[model samples]
Target: MKHRLVTATLSSITAAGVAVALAACAPTAPDSAGAASSGPSDATLTVGTTTDVVNYNPLIGNSRTDDWITDLMYPRLMTVSNTGAKEAQLATKWGYTSPTQGYYDIRSDMTWSDGTPLTAEDVAWTLNEVKKDKPAGTFYGQLGDFASAKATSKTHVEITLSEPNSSLIDEIGFWGVVVPEHVFSKAGSVATFANDGKDGGWVGAGPYTLSKVQVGQSYTLDRAKNYPLVKGGEPIAAKVVFRVFPDVNTEILALQSGEIDAIGDALPPSQVAKLKSSSGIKVEEAAGLGYSHMVYNLDNPDLAKLQVRQALSHAVDYDAIRSVVLQGQATNDHSSPIMPVLKSYFDSSLKEYSYDPKLAASLLEQAGYTKGANGKFPLNFKLIYSLQDAVTSQWATIVRDDAAKAGITITLSGTDRNTYLAATNAGKYDIYAGNFAIMDDPVTNFTLAYLPGGAINYTHVDDPTLNALIKKASNTTDEKQKISIMQQANKVVYDNVYDNIMYTQNLFFAHSTKWTGFVPMPSDLLSIVNPVSLASASPVKQ
Candidate 1:
């Protein structure tokens, strides 16, 4: 098996792809899933994107930018394959040695960026560290049931779980980015380490290493000569430069002006016509694994009410936004965190908040809200989002405009990405827009966002019943039992509108003809420029 595993995600959980027409072509085509490039060799890749990595480590860093770079610089036993299933990457093979124990066949040739040999010891240490961090570790919620990882040898590691975790392969592969135990052991604190400035300071075993950071300009990554998977056949690009614009307009302009050879962010649908008209670039509509969600701040007294959250959910029209604003680039996904892609696990019976200003007003009134002299609801709150993102900016406006119809006064607050994340984590707003990449498993996705103390549980839901259901689902090895338990948890989330999910979006990308091998891969939290696909891309023959 290849080192990179196809991450199971909303895009290909089943035969259907990400959206409507996209879903119609069930049993997705192979090329659409991404592959190794057969294009020109020995080229440099320059990509334009909004935002830069705020933190070097993926463990604490939650931005798309951080993930993009870390994916390229880290080693994973497995990765999301094009088919959306667990496929091996660094671990050529893995299997269960017992009911609750497993082993990974770590690649013997893998080495860190600093030339230290990467062994099963690194993998075991990484997993143990992740456990030590508890639910906050990246992808830890998916594997919180694991007991420990012990090195059996230099080329193999054994994993023992506290209980049976059916999603064992999914959990380890998705979050277990191996860190050099030798290096981190002396750091004292992994959380405070800065792997930047000179040489990007971090050690990795992937195809590319962080070479330099030019502040707001770009993050330069140089291809590693001994990338195990690439070996004799290295990535066609010697260097991958990610230029930050912070604004999609600036990113698009850079792409069109030839200042950047590629773009990894979603191109606004309104500009699709203009981008398509250009002869120098080509745009492709590929399935994406991320979506925007409206989260009610539990700390806000007014928004804490179930009725207020439900009213807000009903205040905006999901289908309208998908139709008018998205320009047919999205799907009317039910607010359930589980994508319909997981046909069985998805709670198909759960109803979505249909747009009904009248019903929304009534719900608000029922929840103790009254229209004031100005004919608007007395309660007022702020809707926070990343102002720099084209989609978020437009989405905030759309929701604000529609909310006015129900006499709900929603003050729009758009700020930088870092600031937005900080506010949500601290629960400092009345309402927040959670723009996130979908997780491979629905149970993992749901618990991560809503279960009590779940790392990204911005709402801070404290229901014991809901949390117990999730815990039960997570610890089981039986698929039917897990699905059944999650069904109950899904109901609780819907009944409470834990996170007012907006809609599912297909990742939209446009690249200059100058680059030829990058293709879109399906992932909940990654873009077409996902490291797996990027490694397969190359510069065009000039």
Candidate 2:
């Protein structure tokens, strides 16, 4: 995801209602026996996060914290259900009218927090502006084709595409965030517009509106009067607060001490076991939609050679990392970017690289690199990873030691999250190690991770053959044909060692047992405390 920032502080907005009204508006919750029970209507849910939100503009910023905050204010056309299926959010129904045309029918009852009616015009304008400016975030690539979106009626929208892309609806509908046309149109350029809500007049269409922000500390969101997606036409919580903690350990302590109710980010594998054994806490697990991987920057002359890249891939002990570093909570089977969770698109035929230090040394020697008097190869590449990631910090040492056995010298650099992101974007590292929270769509993921100039193409790869295959896969509408073409592309990536996919681990989320009704989604980023979850959640009656 992309990243940037702006800072501001606003006064908190309080909801006005009596306890009787709150009880009357309470949503029904399932009892232990599956019968209906009354849930809280005026509770405040506090969530702990590792970092502060970088930007308020959903179109420009795409960090995990950004999504958690902006998602509550800005509505998407569709949302992903627990099963990873597309569900209605703002747009009630959607489908392709023809090979090159798609349509969305939005609900008429929904209105912005400012009382302005949210219509098809806003959706069309959002999509069109993204396609026009090509913002440096997630939404632009999801557009896929150069075309236009027209509001056929106040509630209906038609989108024209230059070519048939079967995945566009799922990609764009679920990923795209719509803003108020009237509010955003005044901005000189949407690409640079911070949308920080410095005026305290932010208008939104979802369950809540950003009410208060204490930079490097906390963000407060007040519940909207009405939200159609949840029961009782509103969120159960009167307000939601995201507290920024310095690290995972600190966040965990706060959750245990009741300083916060939930942790927005997934708990690291090392901490999951202990948290599961703790009292008054519930740990939820979900299938991971992404994987940890190492991307070698082709800009480095040594990494540009396929043999050296492959050699480094073989040098790492995958099983050891999965067992020791990940606590055996991860699956280390897949070799390509299309993780095993994506069943239909994952290519199982491609074999994973075996752990063989001898083979690695032989490949380095074959590539004309001889071991120096220090018993190490001439290579001294630096690998950079986020210091905030405990798993990466632990496993990076293993990688460096393992590579040394193969006569390859690797230097490790662990920096803060912001510095790590900036370095990755500027191509400042010889090797980049990180993880993506969600790669829901294979076609879109490939386009963004492997295609030349892709938003997350840290590898700096620009192979013509791989580019052509991705383009071919993107243009087709046939499911079987697309799958076959993508499998071919996966083989190309695997053979070239474009990226070394480490593993996919089951994500675990911890929250207070005092609250319930959190809906778990697929990816770690959205598994718990998503907008839908926050709206559905309620405090357990004492």
Candidate 3:
């Protein structure tokens, strides 16, 4: 799910009403049930994933790889709990010294995999470098409100934000994953960071250490011997192999045949049903923080017209696609960009763009788009989607159909994900379809999408008013006030200027019935809780 800014404060715009209306069905609670017993003994877990972990170096790492490494190597001062609260991790306990400043008491038991004592300098160094190079790391943008970080003692670290932010602890909990500053002081760029993953430059203080890696096939990790959290201080399996697959189908086949234990991206509902019926395999369908949407490039001359965009939103049949392609497994979203299960920051008052073909035609006509001599709307466009993601291709087809009815003609273009990304960065598409991984916190979900130049803000929105609202939402430390302002901003984005939002997906992951101890996270994003927290859980006895 994509990260968004916190909805801190608002004037209670009419949009708040729509937010409340949508929250009536907001996804809550995980889907998979607890196993009767724990997972297998230090059995080397053979998990399957589709992509390569971009980087293993914590300071420069900011993807699924970070979540995987976070569990095995380094520890955070605090971590987002199942309930979305900042709970103890490396830090035993913490509290605020003032409204905008706080201190964390490190746990005496924490240590690096190398047996080095985990101290406050490591925390200070990690965060200081993040502040210096804010754009380098994915989550560093949140640190713009940070003032200074100081080590009061060997075990105590203090953080002072430039302004009040209620979600400061949540952000800090993620940002607190410390890195060995001593290692990366020599590496200077993103390329060097990529090279670090294979050369063992991607070091962490977690329970597993990088053992060996093959560029595309697999990477091996060994149980950290000095891990302070586990009972035995290491994994039962001496070596864990993370095998890579070319696509979801190949990974699913491996899982069915017992060649792999788990897969990352959830299987579609049809495939999930098959897994449920299988003897040893079990399907876990969790309320995912994942959201997929249609993106309209504002740079397109025709799409820049608000009337044309509205007509397209009105004509598109999201419900039909949700039923046919998604098998009713997804939910319709029309709010503060698709948010996760933490809490509904959805503004209830904004009007939902309902499907009305007649209205769509009228809006298109009003936008000065007329059918050309070829018996189609003069608008010639391309729907760019990833050829690799099957579900996105389905959405593109539905969109293509809806636009045709409105007298608009579209050309379909599908390319491999990496090539598509390269084209997208170079401003290549007229419209695209994709999903954003929602973070556990509201700010991380809302602002990250609408904020100018955010990681996923491919639309290139630069509205001064929206930017100002985002600034206030991030700068203010208070929760209630921040939420209000965020709601107001959400209204502007949803009603007047949003590109397109079709549906937010509910994730469904297929795992083995015998595997226990995996606490399902709301977001599709994965963590190493099994290795760290569930390592001691014993499997159910048949």
lDDT of each: 0.72, 0.81, 0.62
Instruction: Please report how far candidate 2 places residue 514 from its true position, in Å.
Output: 1.2
Index of the highest-lDDT prediction:
2
- Model 3: per-residue Cα lDDT over 333-440, one tens digit each: 653463434355666555557888778878888887776777677787877776656688777888888878777777889886666666666768877677665455
- The model with the greatest TM-score is 2
Model 2's number of clashes is 0
Q: How well does model 1 score by local distance difference test?
A: 0.72
Candidate 1 residues 1-542, lDDT tens each? Answer: 22333332222223332211110011111343343346325666888777778888655666778878888887777656433466556776665544466667777887887889999998888788767754244556556667888998998788887875556655676566777887666654556555553433667787788888887888988887676454243555788899998688888888889998878777787888788889899886666555678888887777778898889888998887787777877766688776666667777777778899999999999988789888899878888898767776887888998899999888998998878877776778888875676566666776678777777787888888988887777666567777899888888888888887777777668888766556565643456576655666655556
C-alpha lDDT of residue 60 in model 3: 52
Q: Kindly give the stretch of ten consecutive residues in candidate 1 with the minimal lDDT sum.
A: 20-29
Candidate 2 lDDT by residue in tens digits, 236-326: 8889999998888899999999999999878888999999999999897877777889999999999999999989999999999999988
Judged by whole-model lDDT over C-alpha atoms, candidate 3 comes out at: 0.62
Better of 2 and 3 by lDDT: 2
Q: Show where candidate 1 strays beyond 4 Å.
A: 1-42, 81-83, 133-137, 140-143, 197-200
Ranking by lDDT: 2, 1, 3
Candidate 3 is scored at a TM of: 0.84
